[model samples]
Target: MGAATGSATPRIVIAGGGLAGLSLALALKRALADGIDVTMCDPALKRDPHGDKRSYAIAAAARRMLTALGVWDRVAERAQPILDMVITDSRLQDPVRPTFLTFAGEVDGNEPFAHMVTAGDLTAVLLEACRTAGVDLRPEGVKGFSIQGSRTDVTLTDGAVLPAALLVAADGGRSRLREQAGIGWISWPYRQSGIVATIAHERDHEGRAVEHFLPSGPFAILPLKAVLQADGTLQHRCSIVWTERAENVPTLLESHPEDLLVELERRFGLQLGKLAFETKPQAFPLSFGVARSFVAERLALLGDAAHVIHPIAGQGLNLGLHDAAALAEIITDVMRLGLDPGAADVLDGYERARRTDITAMGVVTDGLNRLFSNDVLPVRLIRDLGLGLVDRMPGLKRFFIREAAGLTRQEAPRLLRGETL
Candidate 1:
């Protein structure tokens, strides 16, 4: 198969409709010529907000990317900007939760370093934008695909075949397509599991996020906006990601609600006042996996499909958004230059642009998780001192804040800089 002739637009098929796939479709629609065709496929109709009771920390660059794609206004309505990030290291029962380090949580012009966004809200906005952009939204999974010279034939779960110049696998970390393509990945299974839930509190979070480094893992309390309760009153709410040893996650998940609340309160601290469950608790196994390569013949990987890293830094979604923006940029450039979208050169460029950042983040998150997820005295002392020192250095603090905010300012996609891709 080759490029379709007779006025048929160049087709690009993106599998998986999560943040990466949806954002890529929107970005491409905005950047590529109107003659280009984009189709996004997922097994489900929509990613329901209530399905996952977790929120994401969207960095400034990723937020700008959303703005460029025209989805942030809707997202901002429910989004909670993180004004500060406080870090502490202590046991769950420690009498004092001393602040070892803090980040101002702002970039230039006082822009928030990140915002806490629910997966549902983000997906809803992106899905609407894709629809408005004339994207072909398919509610079918990609069962399998075969790549031939200059084209890819994709078979849907319903046995429908769709041909496209390029096929992208954004099917998440355990990407079946990636495996089907025989792409090998290095996997490191952490003995930890992340327990995600939403909580109603008696006090406001004041736009601050907290990360408490416990022996088992890092417990992050991300801020969220007040939600209306059934009693006709607004209640303060927050999303909590409690990382515990893999062995203990079962007990934590099986505990009674009241009993679970007690344990939550201990790790969550009284800073937020009394807490109650706003959503059912869920646990997910944590692991680090990065694909050996991000591209194969006529196929490419994005987001969790490319790399799944530790969540210690909460950059998983941010990294995925970056991928979307970058890939869209590369593909748009390829079309503008009259190059095949799925050409080896094009895919190689995309992979080269993304691999370094993804690998760096994997290493950073893995290192940070390892450094803090234990109670070794010497390691603890060294890390605590390092944190304190960084906290004391204003320039270093700003650098870290900007870096964490994804403001590297080098080869970042135009969308990430609030420009058209």
Candidate 2:
């Protein structure tokens, strides 16, 4: 890419400095360096310090992306690799419950199911990455934007206006910039809220991830590794994502913590010993959402602004980060070819490349949510049989596992390969 003389850096304005937004900025700046000007606008200088503790099941590919961006070393300690995964059905009263497929991380290659890390840790590393990469991370909220012929003009809440050849919206599910760009989205409530909290258990997790399908929704217990307490006793940290129906939020949050832990223990079984209580309960509504289009004029959508899905599969953040990777590649190619980075023609290429994957994941996750969250006898039998069938077919089982881990046919972003830009 040519650095066309004085004061001519292809400008990019990123909105929302959360995991997705900050990551996009860091990745772009690292990839483009001074060839382009990167500015990230986020008002929240400090993260939600007292916020509900939650973790992300970032795929192996996402870890690669972070490594390339120079953020993984800081985040590695906070994450535990998922060495195994189990999907099953049935309860204690019944002895002959169906056994679903079990996937081992090392089945196909030296790949793991996913790495579990808290949201707080993810943000910290990304912020550091931005600082080191010299990304102009502006801490101001976005208010509105206008489409200029060759650029997009963004108005921040603090009465500052900036012009950029490209505008990327990582502002999350309810994106104000996406709306101001006249980008319509397709969204609906899923009648469920994901209740996220950390729990300390008596038994060691042994780097295992478990997802149980209950009547309410999928309950995911992700491992956070064993810690030695001050008394020298082993305590395991795990993030529990309890997707409950919206109507049951109040009752569940207000319910006794001990009783809730007991119920969770019963549902999870004895693989891990007795589960203990930790942290107050929290809840969030679950919804399967996606945007209608990804590109418009000089503006583009990335991360949550592009799509959202049921956390049952734990690929929400992975998908968002993947989008960031693809978009950066496309834009970099355009710059290399001596074309406008935000050209509509180039943006169309990006949209075309990602649309299929985004739509496919949306359908797959939504379908899985419906399939597992129901109690129909026929549905149960079919899924159980299907699960067992996949288990027997090692090839198909490994294929599905690899796909979930974001190790697939697509050309990996440099980060996934652990290469620094």
Q: Which candidate number would show the highest TM-score if scored against the true structure?
A: 1
Off by over 4 Å in 1: 1-7, 46-50, 229-232
Give one digit per residue, the lDDT tens place, for model 1 in 278-349: 889889999999999999998999999999999899999899989998899988877776667888878898
Per-residue lDDT over 117-136 for candidate 2, one digit per residue giving the tens place of the 0 to 100 score: 88877887778778888888
How far off is residue 80 in model 2, in Å?
A: 0.5
lDDT of each: 0.89, 0.78
The prediction achieving the highest lDDT against the true structure is 1
- Name the 10 consecutive residues with the lowest summed lDDT in model 2: 90-99
For residue 234, what is the lDDT in candidate 2?
A: 74
Lowest lDDT 10-mer window, candidate 1? 1-10
Error of 2 at 97 (Å): 5.6
Global CA lDDT computed for model 2? 0.78
